[model samples]
Target: MQTGYADHLNLLCDMGELISVLRDSDDIHMFLDQTVALVARHLKAQVCSIYLYDESAERLVLRATMGLRAEAVGVVSMAAGEGLVGRVFDSLQPLCTGECRIHPDYLYFSEAGEDQLLSFLAVPIHRGAVRIGVLVVQHEQADSFGDMDVRALRATASQLGSALENARLLLSLGGGAEGSAGLFQARTPSLSLVRGKAASPGCAMGPALILGMHRCDILRDEAEPERSGGMACFHAALDKTLAELNALQERFARRLPESASLIFTAHFMMLKDPSFRRRIEEKINLGLSPMAAVRAAAGHYIAIFASSSHAYIREKVSDIEDLACRLLRNLKPGEGKDAEGVKNGGIALAGELFPSDVLKLVSEDVTGIVLVSGGLTSHVAILCRSLQIPLVIVEESGVLRIPEGTPLLVDGAAGNLYVRPDDSIREPFVRTQAAWSAAESFTGTMSESTWSRDGGRVRLFANINLLSEVPLAIRSRAEGIGLYRSEFPFLIRSAFPTETEQYQVYRRLFAAMPDRVVTIRTLDAGGEKVLSHVDSAGESNPELGLRSIRFSLLHRDVFEAQIRAILRAAEGSVCPRIMFPMISSLDEFREARSIVYDCMTALEKEGISYHSAPQIGMMVELPAALELIEDFAEEADFFSIGTNDLVQYMLAVDRSNPRVAHYYQPWHPSVLRALARIGKAGRAAGVDVSVCGEMAHEPALIPFLLGVGIRTLSLDPQFMPAVQQQIQTMDLREAEEHARELLGMSSIASVASYIGVEKRA
Candidate 1:
């Protein structure tokens, strides 16, 4: 921001070219030497060094020094909280001393005989939250690192964070750092650097931690007169690296202990298989190092594989494709963003942030971001989704084709990113904008007793995980929470949350809606919500396997913790509705209700004031559950039709598997017949019935659901108003006639088409 500060940054950037070849180091000392020299040259410092956090020893070891003694390299180690470097490591914060001697927090570790120390700056190189180490810049002339120097160093430190995070994960994925812990950590946004379109509109800018230049010896064979002349030595080096990669892949495959994530295995299998390796060999025959050749070939083929293969391929190929892409990015030219621009007030746009770009995504001031290269469940995408940031992935054609910093639009709901739209293109979006505005306006006209106009009162409840969604729910004016998927906290947490931790989350969530009912589903452990740390049971088919009620039935302690917290969170005032998933029989309900009673008994024993009676419900998903619904109807308070699973099960289709996914029709007369049967069965016994499948938003299914005596619908909050409008327009007689006529139809498609006829018409 200052004239002098600008000069300092420019000087540092200018010095990047000098160390272009220093990246060939395999030794830590070499890396430290190159790093210090680069810093000293860039800052015009008389003294410069790097202090690394030796986590095992709990100290900062002076790795490389410019003006300090030679003996300080490995001998000088201090506690993480002991000295200047230690303080930075402990705090994970940068400190600048304009006058080193007068600085109160400054603690000197080395006995520099006669070196004058005037100014100083040190910053932590963090992958995400953990401070891996610190980078130090010093000068004999005092006050070298001013406010400007501090800012630049901090920015540089971020670059280090980004690079290391990317390098570790990518290398780990590529089969290099095989046994390292490559856990999923959410990217926190830097308050100082805002990402906008720099040279690209569609591309999202993550942390730009460019290592400036390659540090390792990536050999490039000179164009030889004959390919066979130096072939033996070349092949020997290639074989060794390939061996290294295989070992890496094996380690990775072993690290993935979760059941049935075949993609990870496929990645390792590919590395070991000859077909993929032969492609690299072919590239090497044309003179590339086997390492670079394998990476390049892998990128090309894997991209093709991901693009052409089955939906299962996408998930399975994630580890492989992600590894390939990261290696490609690192091998390519440039770092951070190629061009510069601003948006919502911050630096935006960076070169392709492949899945490996682990940027810090801080909570405040985060609005929108676009990733040119990622999928819906890529580590980055999943993390951002958990953080409630709008992100779009899987648009490779747009990444290269779109211009930099062009006005872009993203619809995270639909997984769509509109790049540089023509003026007329924006006109259609205005209608969507109007719909959003109208939805917002309903915040005042709504409360918990809300229902659709057709006298078919459907609860427009939100499915929430993170607290971030609370604001969106309030803004959307959701009547209550339908499915508070409890797995997200477990998904994001480092370990199984203590009761107190779970209670805190529950308390905050309940406090957010003091009057509204919140239905918190007990932790759905298996299938999609896998907890890596927990010792979950493996199943032949996880979706149908030991998941949901099955998981709860066996793992009682885990189940009890969630149930108790849900009741405790309900406290005295806000009515709480608790539900279980995959309930197959009345016995499971009896067992589940026992757990509920046990939870209540515990609370009563603790003498905490709470609801004596919380409404208990079960997801009527499995066929056995539907068949026995009549038996459990008297025991259960309400039945929220889990149509997502019901349609899949009844149709003999798997919703997640894309192949037969087309057969998953909610309109299928069979599905409607099942719904009518269940809804009517629940209604006859005086049990309230609600439908919560994706079909609740389907205009045609509404009439069928209403016709089935389904009194309540719990659709998404955004769809509630529109659904309500539809319900208010139709009478019970009309819906009954429509359902009776449609039920007689042969196909769900026809029923849907029949429902397509406007009720007003």
Candidate 2:
């Protein structure tokens, strides 16, 4: 074999092994140390080091190293933009240089022992759009690192970022390390304060009602002590769990949005996985008791998912744990009881919570929720937001020692939980609540139409994802429904909802707001939000791949069912507008419209009463859509700019990823330009344009949006009053001038400064 071919094959084998170790390991320190050693050996580099970004300190701290001083692991730190490593993080771009010492940005860290190294290659380790750290490999010889070396480092760096995040979460929850008795351990303090991600924005003070952790004690009896009876018991337990989950799903489906109820469906699917059941059966056949077998099987899968490098997969660990506990409780009847003595207006505290548990608390009149280990995007968080409940998530270690029934103050908006507070501190909270109530009453009396000081008016619409939110929209005095996310019904169900079911939902929405215009957006699923019944296979990049309109068009059966339902519901009442999501091209829009026409024709042939033709629109979320706005405007009735996706795709940032969230700026000069272009094209084509994403509700951005000629703004119902109040105080002429200056600005800092200065004036 040729030497080059032999070397390439060796590289591939090394990478495979490296990735295997990275994926299998759950310890962050171990993973980083192993990574540096592997890279240094495979690439023939003199040194390899990983530096993780410390947000609190705003510096890059050396976390692991190979062929360098071992003592510098946690001590050496560099400010962002301070050295070669900092430059990589600041630029969020790779840097390679044959002459490392001569670089202007180079900073000497004697402990690193890189004095003899010449060639250097550094790549930023990013989790989605967020830059978490930097990976650097140095060689003793100049020009030693090539493109292949850079590529390999980048792949490894990506894996490292994901693994690091998973490990951090595990450590925070006290799940990965040994000798940790509980999820958290709080240090003694005068008044313990636990900080967490703000899931739902609100403030509430109440006594702490700690929910007990339920675990089924496993007996060490011989495996299959009762032989065939053991297998029977396991199967029966599984069946009962599945039935319970189904019942829970049905109950939640009635009250919450279908999306919230989908959590149960996921748990139900897990119980049905053949492999998961087989694992337990194999253990049971080995003479293990059914309960023991179930515990072992669940532990195995939980470890695997918890060690995963992907954030989405890592999150499933919580679900698996929840399932295991439920199954165990089912297997051992009378072993665990549901949370009792939940006081009205109490803040429920738990190490972890499932969607069902959160729903129960809500029903018990629990004022707020505080979790030790739950993601901001979890189903429980979604339910809390929908129910308008305050939710704060603190690290387990921070609040593990707080006593039950202790008076506590939870500020979800600020992401803080006070263990106990004195009257001086608590008094401010009471005053704030009173002031908020006054503001709410005042805004509640305002008219639906919002006008500026300069006599310019903009219609305020509500963006709702669930049919249950219709009344809230009406209460907010919204002029209309700007964007009704039409995917929740499909998302939460075990299978596709029948046309009749879809029609009933749409009819209820129309009935709730008979006088207002309702714009229903078609199913936007298949990316982060996946459907169980749909085939989401073979799409390597779901975000930019078969999602949104692409998924709907490919699955014409589902699309037609939805379209037929919407058409039929609008037959006798005011015709609601239909908007297609993620329309990137004129051809895609036309094809979707064609499908709608076909659905109408089919309904006509069946002699079903339906609105044959209704107002059609497209969401301008993609840069491609912005580029072809003129063509789309000519064919569509109106355009709604989905700024969330528009900014994400345009900036090449994933908004959900914490590392790159800062880059997903709505006020970027380019984003502003795109909005302006869409507004201009809509005006030219005599089409109404609306801003419907979260950006529309931002008070700072509201002035700019209005100034850009977008006369229609849709936002969350909770934000409408605040936005209206801000609008009533703004002058359109001043806003237009501010927007013009903002359009010329290049940085988010500049935009923020302009808004801040204007607000102060």
Candidate 3:
């Protein structure tokens, strides 16, 4: 309506020209140059550079630079925490540093002539929580950019990400060797692959499906639920929900897995959790959709239960949240259907599916089905794999954009997926499967420590959670249980499990591991581990909020229960080592150890059977914890570095955050440096440092970790055989040399490229 406002609108529309130029470009290189030229002039910046994470190099490779030397492009790679660029990678937050050198975090790379320095701004280009690349601009003049500049840069960054993904896809389609950038790195695994029970079953064909899932935006920009005003309406919705409760539950039952169904009863109690009800009232008062209101309420419920610092409370809400996610995912599909062009023989892909959707497609004439969802243990995954369907969940974003049928392949054992695969790819899998079977047959009844030609050994272990998991773990022939998370069974139960009940469960677990050294982890809750009983206080960010040891300290009784239960389960046998979670401070670990001592003392007073001395440890998952490694290495008996949380906390990039998850590189130099530092510290202190994080499952990283002085590796049973086999063939001396070389590198991408193994056979 305003005259000058129209001109401003026109200036914005003029950006369409730059967008057109970017669209025409086929690779990330050309697009960056044009983007810098197009936006720098508008933003009043003298220099604009685009840095992308080189997956292989593990570094932020400068792809295109303006007002800099031509040789500088592609030659420079910054560590994830190198400079302003590195800090942006580390934090996943946009920054506008006025005096670049003055910033403590800044690491200057020298090549960009000093004249082009001063004010700096950078925004991460992310596909969900993963930061794929970064867009940065600097000017000779200080104080050059304000909020508007950052906003424009962010908007541009998003477009750049999409463009980069598209270009990579195009390259893949064109059969370019550079196309590997879009695919997850695969190793030419030399390890004897072990077989495990397929949990979520599904058969798929078309593309190896991976969903482009961003982190759930738990932090919505909407008003906080507690401040909303429509409670009476919420009550009415609650009443209506009750009227259809039976039918709703039946539908929900149809929508969830039987394992998940065990927690259905909690859905009822969840609707009753005072916190849950309060969230509903808050949302209803706000006049939001009852479902939206419910979800917001559930988010709050999940947040509290998730951070209860108590495993029992955390487990109590797992299924309830699952049911809610099922409900939410179901409702969302009906909102809009953005169907793309389906290839002649392409199949539909989705992540873990709602049971209703499963039934609908059970008999459909789909070329093949690819689920973007479904964990290995989920019913759908089991069913599909049993059917030998070419489905691949966790395939990154394969399911999202896997164009109809151009040809694809999935080698699940190796976690390799190929899109538009050559027809010949299948032949190798058939052969690999046979080789896997032979390896199994040859190694069956095998009882030998995994050892290399030079006599070096790599310990192989299994991950266990419940008594029900014993059979699976034992069947995997794992020598010992690497991680026994005591939260799952407790979470699924209706009420607090009694001490005897806990003993029975633990007894069953240990009984299965007669000769194995089982390392038991105390309840790891917080950020989704919602305990059903205790009310976990809400914090700004649950991931960084009260969790693990932080929660244990705040909830001493809960911690005592777990400690006593473990002692009781030991029943005087040499108990496995017990490790506390998220120990960032020495006092927290000390308090936890004191509490464990208190539990032991209580047992002693009762004259109950228990190990007189059991190994006690803490997870080095926090940076502050890393800072005190020498102190803890001396105090604690052993250390199990939770690489996932460690990397997340160290880098300040929550892997779950969708917007910046791409930037989460386990091999990032800073993370590697920290890992290497701890690995060395643990080795020097004679501490057994074993990693049970998802990264442990990556065979490529195993050697890297080991070379950094991590001899003990605890991983999932299925992956252990292959990793074990690889270790047997590897020269520890060489591996350590490679790791040392990588440690000296500047970027995670480069380290990954250099250290990550490939499957050539």
What does the lDDT read for residue 21 in candidate 3?
54
What digit string (tens of lDDT, one per residue) describes model 1 on residues 647-750? 88887887656557777677777877788889878978998777777877787677777776786666655666666667767787677887889779886556
lDDT of 2 by residue, 1-761 (tens): 01133443465566556545545644455556556766676676767888988776788988777655554566689987888999999888899998899999999874454656788899998887887999998876788887777777777677677766655665556444442322112233233466667888788888888673221113212242332458888888788788767766666667764534345655777887889989999999998877788778877887687555454565566577677777766666554244223566689877557666776677678988887555565567766876678999754322433577788888888888888887986899899898778755665687768888778888999899787787777878889899998876675444677788788878778778777789899889867766645555567778988889998899899899999999988875565899999998988999999999999889989999987668999999998888888888899999999999999999999877765777777777799889989998999999999999988988778888888888999988777778888888889888888778988887767776777733111
Runs of candidate 1 exceeding 4 Å displacement? 1-367, 372-375, 386-388, 395-404, 411-419, 446-462, 470-479, 535-540, 757-761
Q: Write the per-residue lDDT of candidate 3 for residues 189-294, one digit (tens) a residue.
A: 1111112222333322453222222212222323423323245545654554344444544553343222223334565666567876776656656677555776
Order the candidates by lDDT, highest first — what do you get? 2, 3, 1
Q: Of the candidates numbered 1 and 3, which has the greater lDDT value?
A: 3
Worst 10 residues of 3 by lDDT: 187-196
Steric clashes per prediction: 27, 10, 75
Cα lDDT, model 2, residue 690: 96
Q: lDDT: which is higher, 2 or 3?
A: 2
**Against the true structure, candidate 1 has what lDDT?**
0.59
TM-score list, all predictions: 0.53, 0.64, 0.50
Model 3, TM vs. native: 0.50
